[model samples]
Target: MIEVLGENFIIQQIRDFEDSQFEQTFSGIDKATSNIKNIFESLANKSCKIVRYKKFKQKILNRKPWVDHEVRDLKKTIKPKGAKLRQEPFNLELKCNFFTHAEKL
Candidate 1:
């Protein structure tokens, strides 16, 4: 079963992070840029997830000669969106967007 409420809560957390601003600055010239690292680290620690998966032993397909950066990036972005669309098949907007992106590839 899809934990729709839990997913919505996670999405809300991401939205809140994007909506809020932090004033992370440090004193002294040498320490001026240090806070930026802390800011991003905090963001990752709070917002990102870790995944572990098992891989099957299989032969690799070599398509590097034809696939370009745009295709690679599009595939990367499409993966999670495709997963979400699967979970919420009734979401019309997401379905449309996913199909449009898939067409691009």
Candidate 2:
């Protein structure tokens, strides 16, 4: 699984910080300076989570051998174009075409 911070949750966290007056913690500091410091601390802290996602290794492993080989070849073709096909967003029709092509191969 690939893990990364969730941007949406982070934004919500910032909103919560504003709502909760979390910045009040540094009230002793100069108002302008404290606001800047609070902003920095909010971004730097563990208020965010590491989101996990399944990497393509599991997907390829779960497929039939021939289908997996076709996937690998498709990956090779996209490699020259700078990314894996699996990383691209696919709509229903495109996904159907991909599976159809894999089954044909």
Candidate 3:
């Protein structure tokens, strides 16, 4: 944004300089030198505002792409099955499927 502002400022200064009393070419060498100096002075005085540069921010999305309805349902069942394993053992097939699905991620 600062770069855009600076560019516009320079363009405005140049237009103002061109619109002023200075001629494109002078009759004498001294007159030409003086005109050049005046132009330089005008540009030098019209300084751009000093602004701090801004850093770009990136958006982060926290989501598990692999977790579908099936995965969610499996997770719901797995918690109870895991707890029940302390008393009576759960089915090995369900446990194997859960591990396989989790590892696929």
Q: Where is model 2 more than 4 Å wrong at Cα? A: 1-29, 47-105
lDDT of 1: 0.71
Clashing pairs in 3: none
Over 4 Å off in model 1, which ranges?
1-61
Q: What is the C-alpha local distance difference test score of each model?
A: 0.71, 0.54, 0.62
Indicate which candidate wins on TM-score: 1
User: Which residue pairs clash within candidate 2?
Assistant: none
Q: List, residue by residue over 27-83, the lDDT tens digit for candidate 1.
A: 433343444455455556556676779997998877788799899999998999999
Best by lDDT: 1
Model 3: per-residue Cα lDDT over 15-103, one tens digit each: 76566564565555566566567655655555545578999788795559977878778777766656655454577866776566556
Reference-based lDDT, residue 59, model 1: 89
lDDT for each residue of candidate 2 in 1-105, tens digit (9 for 90 to 100): 112235665566556556653344456346646655666565666555558886765445455555666667876554433333355645565566566655544
Error of 1 at 30 (Å): 57
Worst 10 residues of 1 by lDDT: 25-34
